[model samples]
Target: MKAFDIAIVGAGIFGLSVAKAAHDRGMRVALIEKDTVANGASKGLLGALMPHIPSQWNDKKQFQFDALRTLSEEIAALEEATGVSTGYRRVGRLMPLYTQDKLDHALHRQDESQTRWRTAETGFSFNVVKETPFKDWPAANTAPLGYIWDTLAARANPRLVSAALKAYLEPRITLLEHTKFDRFDEDAGLVHLGDGSTLMAENLVLSAGYEGFDLIKDLTNQSIGSGVKGQSLALKLELPVELPVIYDEGIYVIAHENGTVAVGSTSERDWSHKETEEPTLQAMLDKAIQFCPVLEGAPIIDRWAGIRPKCRKRDPLVGLIPGHKRLWVATGGFKISYGIAHRIAQALMNQIDATSGTQIHLPETFTCAYHFA
Candidate 1:
C-alpha cells in the first residue's frame, strides 16, 4: 500500500481544482478518476462564466464574482506550466432586454454592478448600450430594449481547461485514471480501489460529481441531492475575431475563437437517459437561429449531454460532510460549477489548512453544515 497527504476522486473540474490547491500548498495529492478526465459534464463545449446579477449580492454571488475575476490567471498559469491552452477569454456577455420591466431591472443592475464588481486595481462594468454598439453579436435586433453589456462575463473551453490542469498535476501529483473508488473509511483516511488495491491518505475529498451523490447516500443513507441532465449543441458558423456570449430569452448562443459557435443547453430535471440527444436539442437550435439571425444556416457539428449534481440547498456543497471526521465533499455546483470550482476547492483547502489559522471566509450559508442547520 502507498500513502499520500490527500486522495481525490473524480477528475472533473471540481476534483482537479482541489488537487491543484493541495499540491500548490505543498501537500502530496493523489487524484483518482473512474473515467477519463473531463469526460463528464465538464467535457461540454459551453464554458460560459456568467456572473450573478449584482443586485442580489450575497456570499455565494460574491464568491463566484471573485473566483471569475482570478479564474483567467489560474488557467493561464496552468497553461504556462503544461504548454497547453484552455481557450479561455474574457469576451464578456450581452444579455438582451426585451420587456420594458426587464430593461428597468437591468438598468438597476447596471448601477449595482459598478460597486459590486469593481475594485481599485481593476473593475468590471455593466452598461445599457445602444444596439449599434454591438457590432459583433447578431442577436441585438432581437432585443427590443437594447442590451446589457457586461465586461466581466467570460468563457473557457471546459475540456481544454480540465485537461490542462490534469496534465499539469499528473506530473506533480499521483493521478490514477480509470480507477474507481469504492466506499471509504473516512476516520482512517483509507480509500479502497476497484482493483482490490488500497491507498491511504491524510484526507479524502469526494468530488465525483453525480456519482459522489450516490457515494454520500451510501455513507449517510440520506438523500442529499439529485442529478439534473443537460444537453448542448455546437454549431459551425463563420464569425469575426471575437464577440460576447449572447443570452437572449433562455437560450445561450456562444461564439468561440475558431469560427465555431456553441449553443446549449436543456436542463432536464426528470431525465431517464443522460447519454442520448433528444429532439428538444433541435428545438433549441431552431430557437437560437431565430434569436441570432446570423446563425440561420449554421450546421450542427457536435452534440453533448451530461448530468450535473444539484444539492438539496441548490448552492454548491462544500466543506466536510456533516458528522464525518475526515471525509470532505466538494460537489453540487450545478451550472455554476465551472465558474466557481476554484473557489470551492480553495474553501475546502482552507478547512484542511491547519497551519494557516486564517481560513478563507466562506459564507456561512454555503457550508455543508448549513443544510442541516
Candidate 2:
C-alpha cells in the first residue's frame, strides 16, 4: 500500500484547491477522482464571481467577500507558476433594474457597499447608472429605471483555472483519475479504491460533489446535502473580453477571452438524469439574447449540464467532521464554489494542520458539525 499524509476524493475545484494547499505545505497528498478532472458542475461555462447583496451582511458574506477580494492575486500566482492563464479579470457585473422598487432597492445598497466593501486601500461601487457603458449590451428597455455596476464581482475561466491547478500540482502529488474511493478503514488508517487497491493516509477528505453526500450518509446515517442540476451553454460570439458579466432573472451572459460568450444556467432540483433539455437551454439563450442583442444569431458552441452539491444549511460545508478522527469534508459550495473554493480549502487546511500555529476562523454555519447537528 502507498502511504500519504492525506487523501482527497474528488477533482473538482474544491478538491483540487485543497490538494494544492496541502502540497504547498509539503504534505504528501493523493487526489482520487472517479471521473476526469472538473467533470462535475465545476466544468460549466458560466463563472460569475458575484457577491451577495451588501445589505444584511453576516459572517458567511464576509468570508466570501474576503475570498473574492484576494482571488485575483491567487490566480496571478498560479498562472505565473504554471504559465497557464485562468482567464481571470475583475471586469465587474451588471444587473438591470427593471422596476421602480428594484431601482430603489439598488440605490439603498450604494451606501451599504461604500461602507461594507471598503478596505484600507480601495472600495468597490454598487452604482446605479442610467445606461450601460456599451450600446445594446443590455437593451435599453431592459432597465426602465437604471442598472447596477458592482465592482466587487469578477470572473475566471473555470476550465482554465482547473487546468492551471492540475498543471501546477501534477508533478507534486499523486493524481488517480478514473479511480473511485470505495471506502475507508479508520481502524487501519487506509483508503480502499475501486480497483481493490489500498492506501494508507493519516487523513481523508470527501469533496466529491453531490456523490460525496452519499458517502457521508453511509458513514453518519444522515442526509446532509442534495444535488441540484444546472445547465449552461456556450455561444460562438465575439465580444469585448473585458465586458462585464450580465446577470438578470437567473440568467447569466459572460464574455470569455476566447471570443466565446457563455450563457447559463438553470437550477433544477427535481431531475432524474444528467441530460440537457433543449427548451430549457433555448429559453436561457433567448433571454440572454434579449439582454445582449449581439448574440441574436450566435451559434451554440457547447452545452453542459451537471449536478451541484447543496448542503443542508445552504452554506459551504467545510472543516473536520464531528466525532470522527482523521475524517474531514470540504464540499458543497454549490453555486458559489468557483469564487470561494480556494479560501474554503485553506481554512480546512488550517484546521487540519494543528502544528502551524495559525487558524482561520470559519463561520459557525459552515462547519461539518453544524450540518450534522
Q: Model 1, 1-373: lDDT tens per residue?
A: 7899899989889999999999988999999999988788788889899999899798878888888998988888888899988878998888777899999998898888878887334668888886836564655567878888888999888878897888889889999999999868767778899988899988889999887888888877877888888888888887754688888767888888766888988788898887856588888888888777888778888899999888887887888887787888888888888898888888888898767533666877678778545
Point to the candidate with the largest TM-score. 2
For all candidates in order, the CA lDDT equals 0.84, 0.90
Taking every candidate in turn, the Cα RMSD to the unseen true structure, in Å, is: 1.6, 1.2
Candidate 2: regions farther than 4 A off: none
Encode model 2's per-residue lDDT on 320-339: one tens digit a residue: 77778999999999999999
In candidate 1, which residue ranges exceed 4 Å CA deviation? 119-121
lDDT (0-100) at residue 352 of candidate 2?
Answer: 88
Full-model lDDT, candidate 1: 0.84
